[model samples]
Target chain A: MNADEDAWERGSGVRVVPPVQPRKLAKVPFVEMADGRLQGVVSSGSDIARVYVSSITAGTHGFNCSTNNNRPCGGLGGSSPCKHLRSLVDEAVLQYGRERVARYLQIEVGEDDHLMEGLEGTRESAPAAVVFSRFLRHLAYLELPVTTEPVAEMHWFPATRAVI
Target chain B: MLGVQLAQLHDGDRPGVAEALDLVAGFDDALVHGFARLGEERAAALTALAGAVAASPLGPAVSEAADKVAAGSIGEEHLTALAGARTALLGAVHDALLDRLDTALGRTRAAWEESASTAAPADNLLSGSRSWLHELGITGWRGVDHDLVSSSGQTLEALLAEPRLRRLAVLLDGLAAELRASCPIATMARLPVRRWADLWTRAVLLSQPGARPAASVEPVTGRLLVLGADVHEHGTAVQVQVHGVLEPAGGAPTRLVRASVAAAKVDTIVGPAVWRLLAGHPVLLTALAERRSLDLADMPLSSSGDLAWQDDKATVGAPADPFATARLQLANANAPAVPPLERHPIRISEPVLLEDYETDGDRWTLDGHSIRVDLDRLPASGPLTPELVAASSACIGLVRWDAGGWRVQPLAVQATVKRKPVEAHTGDWAQGPTDPKVVKAEAKAGDAVAVLRERAGRLLRE
Candidate 1:
């Protein structure tokens, strides 16, 4: 747990800079189904730094995570990074320090640039408006909640009992 | 040839042309005769004043009479008096020519009516066609070659039947009034009497000698209704006309033909044969008339008013049964069984999902995380139950059972539900379906809450 020993950071013996506003981890669980993949809901609380982490990890590493071997985003194959994965990374980085964030992202994903290159290609290829929209959506997804009650609440409703 | 000869003689100045020309000259002579009517002394003085009087030894008396007539004060005795010796001779010739004017005008008008009947209704009755030449006969002589008749002796007899033509002749006659005293010749020369008179005679002869063919008439059968008449006949096919009555099967019907008998008249009647034909085959005619329309429904009526009554008659056509037709159609049709009602597709242009829903008696709640509602107050029937109501806001609701009918539900409702948040846990364990909103908010609150329970459960474990 010692920062220097863990190759995290050697404190100058002065003081570690505490985050002005430390971020919370995403509450939604990421499922990989029967296939060797990863998928999850995005929680609120993640920000740009988390988005950056998620982008690098999922996009560049080509971590085969979707339900099927679905690439890019959602069920459709595309160059842009998946909104859910971006949200996940954003949640992780916001929760942990930069070193820990890097270590965890590397563990979660083998390499970081393969899918990210595709994402970068998508960003370069898409219109500025589209890229901006995707970016904002990804940021929004990062900020979504990942807790049990919230999930249940999101899905909750009276059982649709149709009267004849 | 006569026109050519007359043209050559006229000045073609032929003596006849001059003589015919004399008609006008003589007219002038008669005008001058006025100078002779006054006393010899005054007539001589006026004749000397204008030089219209003849310069012969006997001219004084003629000049005197001419002056009297010109003064408009001549007595009957003065008119009876001749101007010297030549007065009698010129007077006689003028009388003869003036007599021809009536014959001429009458002939022209008669010819015009004949031509007019065949031409447009409004062509000039006086000037159109050969009537113009007939009119010219009185004003100037063209040696028209046709027999010339005298106006005086002509006695409007020839023109009596045509009052308008006679009136025209009288009008033309008035134009040559100067000749009345001297010889009526001047009026004849200026009038349209000659030319029209000749053409009229010809038209009359042509008209009188001819007989028109009688119109065809035959007795007809079946219903008949004359458009504008009290006349109605049944089982008769006589060519009906406004004038003539056709002979009925037994005897010739009363002669109503005289009621409307004008030469070359045209009449019309909606004949009986056509009616019989329609009655005989009503179905075919009706079908033919309606064939072009798209309606596939059966014919509306039978030949007989009642189907039962029709069946009694053998000639009545067979009735078309709708069910039989439908069965035959089904036999020929090739189509798959209609899909079950549940699978029947319902399209939604706008979809809204309720994140949460709950009901406590009357109060309703939607998604717990998002908090939308279905309804609130209980109706007379009962409060809305989540299980009883399926969708909201124009949502398609299909009955779970096969025979049930599907419906649409409205989102507008009076309802509300409670909302709460769940705490976050940073652990190496998976979480079940959690409230998406709470998870999002808790995750955003701080670092320890950052670990995703769902991701840990699915991805890392996998």
Candidate 2:
């Protein structure tokens, strides 16, 4: 299928695999990598990773990603598929070839699972930058003079999806 | 004293009679209204009297009478005229006369005021009298020529000697006393007095100390601080360096030795020890112990003196025992009479035969019979050249001793390990993007926040 069809399928919550091998191209890790526009490093040893891989499209090494405001999208090893993670995977596959990419992808998945558990615990602990930004948003509303009226309403992506 | 002299004067014949009556009316009006307008009344009375004398029928009679009074050629008629007219008009005339009398009296008072300002020759005789006049609301004085009036016309001073002046004086004295008691400094400039007696009373009262203002403050300007520390091993005294802003106590900026530890000492001060103290130093324990307490003016460092390298951190050795002598002199006929040894007794020992040796981790153990050089006596290797001796005599007094292969008292033993000051760089990150790669990689990690700093350039701040 074309790219749009694959995106639609993915959006519909069904995983879609790319069709052609493109064997001569750069080898990428395949721990069920989802496609997001972010780039960053993911480490299995330190259990630290940068997400937002699509942001890496802006530069060779750099990646820009929304952390406190935007939800993690897709790319490397695809849990939230941000730009940084996509760049890390793309760079890893390019540098190390397919076999090493697969091994590292396994490690990345294990690390992602552990990190998700840690994140769950951390949710009940001190607030993350994401939660802090939310708090700041709430505070911003409260701090606005009572006389002010909202000029526009904001809607998240899935929540703003049109009804059939 | 004649009975006829006591008779009333003829109103029509009284000198300046209308003006005198006017003054009496004004005075009574002033009394009723409080003394707020007394100055205006005095001016009015004086002006009216001057006008009346120039225009009234009694004008020439008053002149002739005034001339008689001036010439001291007063008669019984003059005395009778004054006594008979001792009505309200006469009373006003009496007061006007007293007012003129005060003008003359003021000359003497003005002199007393000048004298009081000098803070010298501390007595005045007219103190309580004027204050008494002030209290009784009798603050006017205008005396006519008593001799011309043929009235036992008394001067203002003489009038105050009357029993009435006494009552007023007493009442005023009480007020003056209260003022002198509570507000001496404020009143010091303007206490009123009209007589020699008052001057004397003021002089006595001021001498009582309560009337004198005390010193307002004891100011503290600069402090002498010493910052010296010991090198425990050699016991070679190192003086402290002083530093800080020195402010003069009151007026001019004073020069003083400050901030260095050595600037706080006594006789041991290198420069002839004669330094001028810009300010005094508080006696402190470190000052007393180190003998560093010296006045700011006397800082030896101000003059050309030997500049010793202070705060040398290399001095590290066991504290010297007061009883032990590090060097000793030796004399022998066979060996040339030698100077004192400079090598440390702890660092070196006499030549010895090596018997056994073993290595244990970082430490090495060796056994040998060695010739013991008495630490209290001259160092055994001391008979060396002056240059070598100088090079070997470490200010720290620690020395290394070699016996065959083994050396004693390693020079690098650690003593106090002072923390090196951690250098921290603080400044706004260079203007541009908040990207970390933009900064010198070797530089420390930038603060996670503060990424959005912008350059202000040369814009004038509000």
Candidate 3:
């Protein structure tokens, strides 16, 4: 949400989207399917200063949630993932896409299979260090000056071809 | 080399200018003996112009001609007239070249400057087309060469004044003028900037002799009334060029559209055999046989007129009448003057229709009326072309003004088979399924065409 600093400078709280979809395509600012886990950082809806580092482990379907300083999230002591992890999967579906996320998690998904519904796991405490660091790097990319030069990470993307 | 001499006319270096002048004079040096032998005093006119005649606009030209003649080169009769006259002729051509360049370059500069001043970003989707030229590999131009051939607004400031484009612009402008001069259709202006650049790019890549195997691509949009299709093998690649009336989308008038594709691009199509490619694309035979108008969306169109069989959706409809199309769409239609760069024999440079044309000895005549038929320029479609000429009295032929008159080369014949009227293209060009088994094969085809079609979708990705 801090990426909205430009909008704040422009005197708007955030870039406005027309009243269409109830949620943004990127509800969780960063998400990726990596290291046998569906992982990302989710901004805490209640606290402006906080974010939850979340992950759903592959095969075993184990899950974990924690803050930046390794404070275990209270919502981890439950059968279901907290709202932050749920929102992370929702945005992951919009980002890496549903089929990709399902496959990476080793789920033999059915048509209409909810990504989170296919996973059943117990409380798991995994270090949130790597995902939080990746989230910080993503924010750094957003701060880059607008340029025509190709972005190294986006070489395979179609829209980036022109900038090259 | 003449281009270099023209630029040197203003050079202060005497030896360089003199050498260039000698070359220019030498270009017509052979004409000296020929014209003098014919007893025309004009041959030696340039010889006596006085080497000091440096005050004339083509002063350096006069001084050079005189020096070449005076320095034991005969300050006299025959060589003088022709070289001197040739110098003047070159002067006039040089001036005309500047005029054409000024107009074209000025328009490009103005358009780009206007776009530069804009605040809000304007949607430039239909602003112009993009192309992929296959050289060592596919090299693309956003539009034009990004200089003289650049699309409006793509470049800024004096960037459009780059020398490469300006130099080629002269040659291309000359080519465009010659093509228009021979074209029978009333003169419209030259090709639009983007199309002109497309022609220029093709000219640079595939214009060489025996270079048919090389390929370049452009996209085809809108609907086209299919007239005919043919495939040719050029050692390295099999080429297909389609001729038809293109009704461009966004409500543009119907005009003749030529699109091509090379078989070499199809990595799976093993060799450059017509049958090998055609077997995979039986639809080419289907369209050539029956009148089929196709509406294409984002297809890889290459060369002069071949839209290579690719996975692009080509929705075909019936009632494909080439004759009726010529009448309504081509008759009185402004024939586009494109740079005749493609090696493909049937460039469809000037498409027109005729009825009850008169022929005597070798001359053919038409009313120059409307309601045109498929008229191919080369008439290289085998024996059937001449037969359509000798046997069928009424047929559409591509006409060009050459040797001081029009030449009608027939491509399609208007006749009656059984009780019904039939429009038949001269030769059997497309090779695929024939008889009732392959009648509607154009709408669908083998995997080769499907692969070619699907590649267009992923072309930009990889």
Candidate 4:
């Protein structure tokens, strides 16, 4: 069993599922796993899973996956998106609606890229920003309306949000 | 004596008759001194008098007496004739002096009557008295009086000795005494004696025939707002800024009035009433402003200082502690157990947040506006408290304008809290109720990992 699978097994029996609502995403505990990846724990009754998502890039498009039963679907480094990750993205769409979510993602991703050099690869130091960015991207992909115009500048996001 | 008789002839209507008499007395002195010495100077003095009385009844008699005296034909008859001529000549000069005085006095009285009838109350008194005193020219009071005596060429004793002038002086003295008793001397002392004399002259003129009553000044009516107030030490006085909206009787547009009352008249005049009015009890100020008069006939207002609104008639027996009386019956029932005399209300407006406040010894310095108020003098019942101090430091409140500074009232304080942004990883983040044991274990492991990371970094550097 892989580390992701082991982690899921250890937390499964004692897991407490959060309410299945978009607003409940704010209460979920997320941790930074690497420079561009974030991990979140999702539970259904007595079954628990660990979902991971990567930061968006111009060409790579990023990855999303989750552990099932006592094992990761492929591995911790899997590239394919998972049903659990899709569920979270659907929740984000329900919470923020289509247009706002898209704007939020555009602003967040733009700001992260701008500050990436100064961050010095210290993702763990800003776990909140990583989790927020992932949720924001999920909302953008699922709920945003299709538009021909390119995203504009990101000034609405507060400076404190970027600090984290 | 002849000058006095001349003055009495017309009931002292003539001005400067006494001064003319004084000049006659000087001539008598010269004659007596010249005769006692018996020299050529005496002959010269007699000859000058002979020429001066040439047109009078004694002219020929004095000229013949002078010839005998000049030829060394000294005898009792010649001497007696010369003395008699001198007396007759003095009487003739007195008559001529009275003629001039009559014309001057008529013109003066006419001018004074015109000015007095139309003058403002204070101006009427001042100008009328100044006219009379200028004519009398009494001296020996001091300062300005000395200058007047020197300028007018008269002595105090000579002016007082004249029965007619003495009577006028008595009348002026009575007026001065009345003013001194009714108003503070300190205020009057600020003016020159000539001004004071003018005030007394007006008083005397008012008592004379055809004198108009003190100018019927229209009392001001308005709403008075106290912009600021300050209480002096030991509750002796209070200084205040009064903002009023005065509406005239004939439906004139309302006008805003700003006036500052000095510390001298604060307690006795309108300060206490204004202070109380600003403290949210408007009974006294409202009554005074609305009625356009304050009937202090029964009130024990201080009679020591000059009132700011002297033009307004204040009848005796008005309410003395109007503010305190109103406050006691209504708002501040649990006020400090101090004598009413000790209470001094200071008005304040425009509450602003205080950034900070501190007390050092007996002085309290409030931040934000940087006001320093006397710790002991802050309004009673609103003494400094920890809550007030804390709120002052945290927020803004209304401060009162003092004489030249600012004062803070405890009751006028307001506190505000600042809003802050939410920080990450600070509060509970797990969605549902979690197992306590698991949570504790996770927290310990997290701490251990942080320690391990720090140790690894230090080791690598070494």
Candidate 5:
């Protein structure tokens, strides 16, 4: 290397801490349903995807992505909450209290009493306490060591192909 | 009884007059003391008695004796003469006292008449009540007599009660109270009456209804940053733009306000020197930047029509004459065609240093361009001084184009100090050291130029 490049390489070893992120989340277009659920579409360039925020249990929030093969989204695998779900819950708690959220959900479900009755036996078969215990067990697995080595050999590529 | 005894004595009756004379003789010492104390009034009384007795049957002897005493020639020192003059002198003393009382009464009547015309009833009541107090000979009327004090107090109270005069009275009272509080009572009493009257008059005038209070005008202050100056139509007019910060009294300074002055009004506003300096923009901008603040106190807000003739006069002088040699071309020689003279007025506005000056000729050099100044057009009696020439050397001159190159007939000069900062040499790779040979050549040229300038100056002086 040249003398200037050598000096720069020696200087670059000093640790650089990244700047702290702002508490305020970026604004996104969203709709509030009668059932106290939030639905929105977040687009990155040409890729548009629908996302939904719903409570798993009372006072517990979760989100799902329709475009992600009907999987739980926002880095949340159907258990622990993600940033999007947390942001939506924060916005809803700020706009409407917990009591109002509960009232709205009750009113939304009351309109379809017959459908709720059909699912009543299935809901009774799975107790809320057991589901909560299973969610906690999944969250504990995230902290356990899964491997001791690199998961895969990483490869680098040029961002764009150029004519030579 | 004395008058009856005198009458009897005058009719030559002996016993009754002799008894009265004996009684007067008994009071001789008292009479002498009374006459001595009375002085001039006693003399006047004796003189009147002498005149009255002259018409009486008392005869000329009695009147002559009284006249001598009245003239102060005879006194009790000559008891025989005094006794002979006694009847007239004693009568005069008694009559003088009565006359004094009558004169006092007359003066009182005259005083009443004067006061009746000039003083209101309130003033008379105050004066009349104070007359007795004045008789007591009190030095001041503040608290000695209650009637006089109350009367004066009532008068002041009534004056203060007047609607029209209330403000004036209050102002005066406040001033008086302040004076009384600050000074001794003797000093307040001794204050000059005329000064107090003047103060009162001014206060009244100032406090008059509809008299607008004097407006406090704060002087305008600013920093004038001259941006550019354009000398239009030669040297007749100039247009100048200046960026300034105006600091009004009791207000924040407003920045970057542009003020432009026209050339025709320049002479009357800031005079010709500033105008010439402004017209030569680079020097002015440099000086303004160096000085930071411009003193615009000499600049005027309105034009006075003084420099209106400069533009017209610039176009009016004698026409240029071609050299005689230009006319003499040899036959068969290929000569250049004579071009028509351009009549368009050419103006040069630049700062120049007058290196050489003389009555015969003068030279001004600006940015390597040297021009001859026509000095014959200057007023003959007023010769330019060395200091004036040196000062004018650094000034801007207006030159016009003519057949004989550029000529400056009327050069406007302003007195100003040129500030040049010392520049340090910063080493840069692109620049190289100057050649010593070129520097030597430039120095030789400068010396030659200086010698030529001195020779030209000497010639001009001659």
Candidate 6:
């Protein structure tokens, strides 16, 4: 076999997650892997001021899509995720990398598999205001002056327990 | 032969099959007079043995060997070869016989082909390969004889020109070599041949005469829910070292199953980094790219963590979340302290999935302790390492101790890119869309965080 082909086959078992399927990133401005789910902010496609907080966990694939004020997405009725939540995942993959998104979602990806395709769950509700607020807080951090000294606004420390 | 015997098994020929295998198995009675009297009785005994295992993959070779031995002039090794053929006919279900048979494969002349390989293909390679397999008298269990494994060495050597077959030869020899090596079989990169009969069914002689053995695995048992696996190239052979959790039947606590599976090629058609795993592995290679726990009732494992699984014993389970499963399974499991003098160890005992950790510069704060992240251990073949490490993120990683201190090889990561939380697994990290700002930020001579820190230092100087 050709060396290039050999290179292609050699140690190539681990796959590179293809770039997340092309989707409109602008529709979903903020995304993050947190709280054992993909939680993010997704702007309403029709309404200018409307934005929704969307989340879907890995194992349960339990999903939620609601406005910052807690109004539920009308598209949330059926078994499948509403478009807003789908948009949120698309952008999350873009920002975090597909494997990270899948890992956060707790799913293993297949070649040509849409990140959201493997998920199946009922539409559960969560506070959009909190997710939207986190997005705002995330934006707030970017505006702060960068310095080695910890800023008061960013003064958060993880609670620790000793490992024996 | 398996199809016939399996059908026979379905037909309730259990006792008959076992008896057929045992007939030749008791050859010491037939060979009382030794080589001088290796006349009709000896020839008939060898011939009967060949007939008894006619369903074996190596049956033709056994029959051929019997004929050659019957021609009146033969040594004691010929009788040993015939016995080996009979033993090969008996499946892995026979523990003692297969052990001796697998041990002898290393001494076979064809065993040397494992270390030597050529990129060249034989003339009429496909046809040649088909002929070579046919010449070996492979018919699954019907007639394939493992005892005669060395008899085909010369023929196999001639076909080493075929790269794929050559790879198979190397794999066979590799398995045999593992059996031969002084090191414990558990630590070997390859699985020990579980059954002498499997050699006949594996590779080109399977199902049909010349079809490749990609799936259609005959397994023993036990399955692992893959947490994560890295496909690494150590030398010539490739390895997919997997870390997974197995919840034993009957509500037992899930134990970690670390399998360093070997493979011949990346099965691109299946999923990302999914290996067309080396033949005879219990779990399906597709499991590497799946969230489902692999299906196998018996997974070949040693106390030291070496294992091989079969597809036959497999049944897919509910989807698994590697990080979550590891976190839950390894919770009370004490992280093994790095033994003194261990340096850059590839793996650690009692792997713990440290969750919700923050990465700052070279240090990662998890639970409470801040451990220095060792970048050097991050293999270069893994393209996602730098970004996964560079981005200040909430990380999930397998914690290990390096020469410096505790380090983590991130399995998945969630980072704020352009003020948004993004997630990734090492294998599929590139599948997500790239943030222009992150890319631009990385490209700039000085990164935003570094530039800011530098200005603060300049101000101190001023």
Docking class of 6: incorrect
**Considering TM-score, which of the candidate structures 1 and 4 is the better prediction for this target?**
4
B188-307: candidate 2 lDDT, tens digit per residue: 332221121122222223222113221122223322322121110000011222211122335443222223222111111111111111012222222323323223332222111111
What DockQ results for candidate 3? 0.01
TM-score of decoy 5: 0.14
| Chain A TM-score from candidate 4 | 0.31
Top of the candidates by lDDT = 6
Select the stronger candidate by DockQ from 1 and 4. Answer: 1
TM-score of each: 0.14, 0.14, 0.34, 0.17, 0.14, 0.32
Better of 4 and 5 by lDDT: 4
Better of 1 and 6 by TM-score: 6
In angstroms, the error of model 3 at B270 is 18
Q: Per-residue lDDT for A38-117 in model 3, tens only?
A: 78877677874576889998788899999866898877666878878888888766544566567657766578777777
| Ranked candidates (lDDT, high to low) | 6, 3, 4, 5, 1, 2
Clashing pairs in 5: B45-B92, B238-B263, B358-B460, B359-B460
Residue-by-residue lDDT tens digits, candidate 6, B1-462? 012221221232233445643453334323323333455765677788778657777677667767776785453334334645544543322332222222322111111011122233443543433443333332212222333333444444443333345434433433222222212222423221212222322323311223321211122344466666543331113444566666555554445555554432211111222222232443444454344567557655433233444445566676666666654554432111111111112233224344455667777664444555544334322334555666745554554422212345565556666787765554331221144543443343223223322323432233
Superposed on all Cα atoms, model 6 deviates from the true structure by an RMSD in Å of 26.6
Off by over 4 Å in 5: A1-164, B1-345, B348-370, B374-387, B390-399, B408-462
Q: Give every prediction's interface RMSD.
A: 56.5, 46.3, 26.1, 42.5, 47.1, 24.2
Give the whole-model CA lDDT for all candidates, comma-separated: 0.24, 0.23, 0.40, 0.30, 0.27, 0.44
lDDT (Cα, tens digit) per residue for candidate 5, span A32-104? 3222233332222233333233232222222333222333454544344445544544444333443344443
